[model samples]
Target: MSLPDPPAPIVHPAEYAFGDQVASAEEHLVGQVDQLLRTRFGKPVEAHLAAPTATDFAALRRWYGERAKGWQPLPDVEGAAKAGRGQGFGFSHGDQAFVMVWLTRDAAEGANPVTILRYGKAG
Candidate 1:
């Protein structure tokens, strides 16, 4: 069977002032997630861009939760660079670390599409 398509990279909301600052961090996160998806499912991770509506949010949550089963939320990201001004949540699968960055309180809402931002074997 083929793998499910991954979520697309999130588009920075208009409120963000300095998105370039986080470009590296964003790439790092994406890479990590892609690696995790490839390793776990034996296929390249595909990202699907979607609006943060109830249906989309639910689908995103279900997808991430299913993929992240047996994975625990990491308390902190070792060597994880501090985001200048963005807000997000982090989780872990064993030593692997994952992070989701966003500005809104409800990252599930507004324009947050790439909810599962990053995943990697934490250092």
Candidate 2:
């Protein structure tokens, strides 16, 4: 199945530390997700791909009745070079998803720890 081109790379501010080391984090993420889909489901006739956002994480926490304790995306990446500038991804097929989350809050290098969660379509 064919998919629309991924969204344009996020134009980060000068202060955002998505440097050369992790410059292609977004592309890497899309590639990772695509690889997973191809390996497991061979791509779907109808698929949805979305870049994760700060609001998305916050909503997840809120949806689960969790309270935030002074957490924020660091303006400069510090821990790991990741697509943590709310630039990771999520792919959904039907009612299920293979979602990616940044473990390190706002990586100092515009990249952070990545966690992928699979739901609904386990098989």
Candidate 3:
């Protein structure tokens, strides 16, 4: 006899922002990221925990900095950069556009610790 099929994983909505708050569970965050990638590039892109260099970090900083005022306070670019170290993902869809994501862990008790460092797009 075959075992029962496993239950589907639960995916919670993620709030993309820059801060020390727990954005969502790791699994949820991964799902959101994958969905975004698939929507933009027609395929899922995995995020890497590799640290970003100063230059690489700066590019993301600049991109987010330019549009920060319109959204939220110029997110702690330096902090995000530091947190993003070894925890960021970058993807491109030809010349159409590109997306970068940086994540930070929340230290709160029972917190998901998968907050988004930054989520921005560039062309």
> Which portions of model 3 miss their true places by more than 4 Å?
1-24, 50-59, 63-97, 106-123
Model with the higher lDDT, candidate 2 or 3: 2
lDDT of residue 42 for candidate 3: 52
Q: RMSD of each candidate?
A: 8.6, 11.6, 15.0
* Worst-scoring 10-residue span by lDDT in model 3: 1-10
lDDT of 1 at 30: 49
Give lDDT: candidate 3, residue 25.
Answer: 38
Top model by TM-score, which number?
Answer: 1
**Tens-digit per-residue lDDT, 9-97, candidate 2:** 31223343434544355445445444545554454232223323333444543432222122222222222224333333444444444
lDDT of 2: 0.37
Clashes of each: 9, 9, 4
- Candidates arranged by lDDT, highest first: 1, 2, 3
For model 3, what is the error of residue 54's alpha carbon versus the real structure, in angstroms, after optimal superposition?
12
Choose the strongest candidate by lDDT.
1
Per-residue CA lDDT of model 1 for 64-88, tens digit only, reads 5577666765433222323323333
**RMSD versus native structure for model 3:** 15.0
